[model samples]
Target: MSRLRTPTHPTYCRVVRASAWYDLVVTAGFATPWTYVLVHDVLSSGGLALGFEALPELDTWQVLFANLMGSVVVVWAVLRIVRPLPEHGLFDGIARTLFATWQAYALAHGASGLLWLFFGIEVAFGVLQLVPWRWGRNAGSVTNDASPTDGRSDASTYWK
Candidate 1:
């Protein structure tokens, strides 16, 4: 049996919001030096306990990069959580694709296997946000033949 698909707007918004929540929870620790220290230790310990290679010790530059990434991601995640718009999902999906690509590169270069966990999540959320969603027949009482004619660029409605 074919599964029924829901409307694009609410489902896409929820997915975007959910990704933001996940980002907030995960990256919030990396936003500060003290918290990043604790996060690094915990991740290292967890890796060893799980029989995976522990994360490498970070130098000052590495720590700075981590904190900077965390700070930027945390702020972006907040914006998505607050607005949860379709445009946000598109941009976030693009960002996730970049993140997943770099993650794959790091994994190939012998970064900790623990990174695979995050890589998987990045791929999942990226795909979820990037996939096109069809409008449901009952959604906003929109008929299947209905199309938007607003002045927005074609790129915005391309997926629709």
Candidate 2:
């Protein structure tokens, strides 16, 4: 470690990077099934079914639209994994929390049990990202450096 004392701990960045990689894996798994699930009910024989059962019959176009959306998520996950940005954590956390709430709502409306597990995970992820973003150390503060303008050793320029 460089021994630069910043508000955000050094380890926090690693954790965020790891989380981004996890997200990448998860999204890839989901994206891999997008076309297959959109066209065929592959899990019907394995005692499991995902997505809306009535969706296929109700509107074929809707399934295609959902598949396209999944592709977008996959791309975003790849970007996050390749270049983790802690500054964007709060927005991502808020989005995950919203998704979890929606999943809970779906479960309440008699959705599948798998969504329950996803809801828990989404909520946990949201908390993990949000907590560090809000309560962890702030970045870009120097305790040892002096400001040229003020001629003081204890100088801090904080950015959120």
Candidate 3:
């Protein structure tokens, strides 16, 4: 098996926590209609000021989708913040990769240049999160599906 150097435990944990905090702050606004209204305005204004395409006028479907995404991401971020585990980072990285892919697709279809800012962050965090798993080491040599306190070998304990 090819082994790549991975970040130490502390570094990996810090990165995970940082990503969680970022998600909590950024996505919190989209979690509700009241907040999404303000967030939309801010993003639109910012995009225009930066000479990028502003977000289109709000639609019920768009708001609903954004709310759903925001709610799920906020909950996920909270979990990571509460417990910065190696597994959390690995999974979160995978999620970020998926999100980045969709974001890129939207951009290609002329969604908005402002999305580039979020895309960059997602890619950076995703790469950092997956690097440890890509190597033989699972975030400071932490074994996947292994519990330190119990001797169970079930995969259900991965998130615990």
Candidate 4:
């Protein structure tokens, strides 16, 4: 009887783990493109009229790269949330805050109010993404940690 129960437990755990991984993959894939667009749009619009205009082209690439990084982070975060692996709440928080701050800065510096509105929405979404849910803290929150070395966990480590 104990042997049967033990086998069942691991099987159940495997199923649960697989489902969690599937969900995270789906979520990260969905969020990645959206975040890329959001950041790209804000930077393009906000940086279009200044000495920063040249910067937006660079920022476009950066946004793409950042989105990729973010997607990886999101996957790891989902896993951590599902499995309760090493706690990354503090770090995720900081990331979200930095995203928000960047959006706000873009809004403030942009040439047009419309750009500001766009940045504002990005800021809001960035904040929402960081909100703690059943899956664990949002990936952005990991940025809040003061220890730079400890804060630098590879976004993909959680998947392993």
Candidate 5:
């Protein structure tokens, strides 16, 4: 069987940490149920809730679903903060894309202007994670992408 290779450069390490932090901050700031409650009860106007004005009051199952999702999401953010994995960047990109899509849908349905701001943030983070690169670059810059350069196995770098 062939072995799968992934990025091992210090530049890649930087991207991993940066993307993970983005995920952690964004998830904690917006994905938590407490934040939802605050926005729904205090900040919300024009019948808007979670970027959707058309959504009615959540029922029993809906509330349970939200709680369950939030619980897992908080865990995910904490894990990202604790362990920065380059491979998870792909999944984070997918997650951000999905979120941006939903926000875009809400905007299309006349939800709120605030949703656009969220969409922008999501898109930006998604791009950063997907790209897996540093912010700036010069021709002289070089990174060691050689196999096991840091004495850490690829498997150990991810999902541990």
Candidate 6:
């Protein structure tokens, strides 16, 4: 049957759009640190210092992992931008777990301030990720127009 439906509440659509934009901004913001660190490492032979003593070893791995995670997040964020939530659910969960690990590592390594900031941002994104787009087949607002029939919605399908 071909079904025609209208949103119960229009504000929910705005919320979904705003949430997606927030995710995009957060993803881009996360990438900034990686870029800054990379440039610092390249420009300064002494390497980037986090207001502490020489941490060449720690810095190397941390920067590498941060860059890799940032790249992954950017891709996920693009998927979210195109498809909205609940589409990349599993990938979002994995990203959140990895972000938690990264936060813990930063805390243990004496970057608690930075860790707390990242933790806060990640928490917000994680909460958004858990939002249900389809609830009990009632058709939640966010996923209503999202279908594999469109190319944009297919971004996260590959991960599933």
User: Considering every candidate listed, which one attains the maximal TM-score?
Assistant: 3
| Of candidates 4 and 2, the better by TM-score | 2
Please, what is the TM-score per model? Answer: 0.79, 0.61, 0.82, 0.33, 0.60, 0.48
Q: Write the per-residue lDDT of candidate 5 for residues 1-160, one digit (tens) a residue.
A: 2223444545555565676666555445345556656544543463455554444464556555656656666677666566656655657777888988988887888765756766898898788776653433434323324426554545443432
lDDT tens readout by residue for model 6, 9-92: 333333444555665655554365656464444434432334333334436566666566566667766665565434355356
Q: What is the lDDT of residue 59 in candidate 1?
A: 80
Ranking by lDDT: 3, 1, 5, 2, 6, 4
Clash number for every model? 0, 2, 0, 13, 0, 0
Measured by TM-score, how close is model 3 to the native structure? 0.82
User: What's the lDDT for residue 35 in model 5?
Assistant: 67
Q: What is the C-alpha local distance difference test score of each model?
A: 0.80, 0.54, 0.82, 0.45, 0.59, 0.51
For model 2, give the 10-residue run with minimal summed lDDT.
151-160
Rank the models by TM-score, top first. Answer: 3, 1, 2, 5, 6, 4
TM-score-better candidate, 2 vs 3: 3
132, model 4: CA deviation in Å?
Answer: 12
TM-score, candidate 1, is 0.79
Give the TM-score comparing model 4 with the true structure, all chains together. 0.33
- Please write out the lDDT profile of model 3 over residues 1-160, one tens digit for every residue: 4443433456777789899999999999999998999999999999999999788999999999999999999999998898776667878998999999999999999988999999999999999899776455444433433454453333333333
State candidate 5's TM-score: 0.60
User: What lDDT is reached at residue 156 by model 6?
Assistant: 37
Give the clashing pairs for model 3.
none
Model 6 TM-score relative to the real fold: 0.48
Q: What overall lDDT, based on C-alpha atoms, would model 5 receive against the true structure? A: 0.59
Stretches of model 6 off by over 4 angstroms after superposition: 1-34, 38-60, 131-160
Give, for candidate 4, the lowest lDDT window spanning 10 residues.
1-10
The worst-scoring run of ten residues by lDDT in candidate 3 lies at 151-160
Worst 10 residues of 6 by lDDT: 1-10
Q: Which residue pairs does candidate 1 place in steric collision?
A: none
Query: Candidate 4 lDDT, tens digit per residue, 113-148?
Result: 444544454344334333432332344333322224
